[model samples]
Target: MPVRNALEALTMRPTRFLLSSWPWRSLAYLTGGALIGITTIFAVLFLLAAGVVLSVLVIGVAGYLATVLSGVAVGRLERWRMRLVDRDELPNPHRHPGAPGLRAWLMCRLREQATWRELGYTMISALMLCWMDAAVVYAAAVVPTMLLFGPVYLYGETSLWIMIPVAACTPVALAVAAYPVTAWAGARAAMARALLAPRSDDSDAKLVELSRSRARLVDAFEVERRRIERDLHDGAQQRLVALSMQLGLARLELADGSPAATQVTAAQQLAKETLAELRELIRGVHPKVLTDRGLAAAVGDVAGHAPVPVDLDLRLTGRLPDAVEVTAYFVVVEALANVAKHSEATRAAVSAGVRGGRLHLDVRDDGRGGADPERGTGLTGLADRVAAVDGTVALSSPPGGPTLLHVEIPCAS
Candidate 1:
């Protein structure tokens, strides 16, 4: 095993572990921690004494405030020192102050959970952790040094045979001491990491901002879709409809069996077909019904159009947020399209309702059920769409029959 850290170094063969620099590094880390811990105890006591002695003055408040904020400095120093025994970098959990000023920065630090956690760790380090570290280093390093020099100091007081044997065992004792020193250092580093690092439950500012940015992007896309749909419906489709009507009148005026009549009739047919295609394209871009009516009506329209017989059980009593409605509507559209194209089943069902401020939707088919999202089904795109609104997707498809796709989207309207 490679010696990435003190803990990993412990897995090496005994000779390799003793020869490596990890033992020395661990000793240095513990020594530094012990020194810092002693300094912290005196500093905190001095601040408290100053605060109490000058309690009548505003200057006294500064002392008490600094005592509370002491952890900010300690946390930064400890993170830097942790590199000696742990190869991994420890991240600073504090967020930068949103505004610039000493007061702003202090307020930000005071508001953070990590700041208080660091304070608690600093107290533990001063009162207990650092003492334990000192004890381990003293036992490991100090005891070996005394044994190695014992023969010279006690030569006349003790028998030569006993002194010689004790001195000879010094090398073995020192080598054995390395394991306990490194082990304790690794454990201390782990504790610092757990206390000072940001976790999933820590309400990280960056994570919250990322989610807000994603929702904004989804809203921007929806707006663009409506713009394109409007342009096609009001611009190109209207022009095509006019062209078809003109061609129809031209055919009527031409001679019954004339070449001009035949050409006009063909042009009219082509124009009508093109207008139909454009209308469908506009619907796919952004359904007018979805914007005018609510999700229930939109879903009912989609169910009526699915090739496979679709039974709709919509229990929605009111409208949902636009993002939630759009996301849920598309999920149903894509799911039913998959059923019509892939599922051999003759019937499918769509159900939706609003409960606990979330919109739940389900699409099911009695097909030759083995739907795999990894196989480039539209399910992957569907999931990405739902996730934009902080929604979830669940699929259950067995090999023999029946496939069910369930979706839940938060609709806090």
Candidate 2:
């Protein structure tokens, strides 16, 4: 933290910086850097020697591991030295491995780019970084200390008076030198931040945001479809039904021999047929069964309509989230449709249940089973729809046999 205020002290009156302990803090910070640099040099030298000399003995493996660890060790020391000028904790950008163990940790570190960056920093520190620190300390603090104390060394000689003038200017020079030392510390900390911290969240954050956007779109589409369904059921379907009833009454009122009687009966039949077709369209848009009775009932109802005989066995505790339930229902429907159209199977089975916090659906048909997305079964579109809710669809249909489609969707109760 002392060095964190290093820049603040520099902006003050020159006399204030000289009077304060900032110059001493800068000196200590540089001295620590020199020590770390020396340690890095020796450790690197040792690893190189062991790696080359012990290569035949297979002990080079230990040397290789040590080389990687040394870089990380030096980086940590550099982070700690920031306390001389900085107070903020530097966060490591490396991710935790899914498993925990020494080998796993080593693999995690080795695979990260930061590990190589640290090694590069260590090389620079060992080569000339510490020399620069030591040079600054000598020019700014150490040299001045000796010059200010010269009078003590030459007390009995005429040189003492000459030393007095130099000593008088020593504090000013030292105060000015503190700026570079503090500047270097700031640069070092900035480098650590740049190389060690998370650069940007564009990759993971954008993916997550994209998924959420798709899910929202799906929900909105469902809402619009339901609205359309309601409109048709209440407005168009009801009117058509009333029109059919009026035509029937007209037919009954007309005499059996009247020319209008046959025409009225035909008009009634057409209206009835149109109303039935409209009802089916409304159901296809967004089924009422799904909204009212949940997924289990919805699946059973859908299965009952398939051309192929369907055996439905669905188990559940209660309703799932709207997004998951809707997505899963459509996936099952599409799979069954594909089965009916292509499988030519005499019988199909639908099984569903929730396990491991996910809704699972397994649809199978006993028939000709060479089905794929590339053949225009709509499997690709179905997969994308399921993916909107982070669900998956897998199809397994070998030639000339049974076809099995499995779908899984995450849903929390």
Local lDDT at 63 for model 2 = 91
TM-score of each: 0.79, 0.53
Q: Give lDDT: candidate 1, residue 32.
A: 92
Give the Å error, residue 333, model 1.
1.1
Which residue pairs in candidate 1 have backbone atoms (N, alpha carbon, C) closer than 3 angstroms, thus clashing? none
Q: What is the C-alpha lDDT profile of model 1 across 245-339, one tens digit per residue?
A: 89988888899989999888889999999999998788778888999998999999888888899998999998888889889989999999899
Measured on C-alpha atoms, candidate 2 has an lDDT of 0.79
For all candidates in order, the CA lDDT equals 0.89, 0.79
lDDT of 1: 0.89
Candidate with top lDDT is: 1
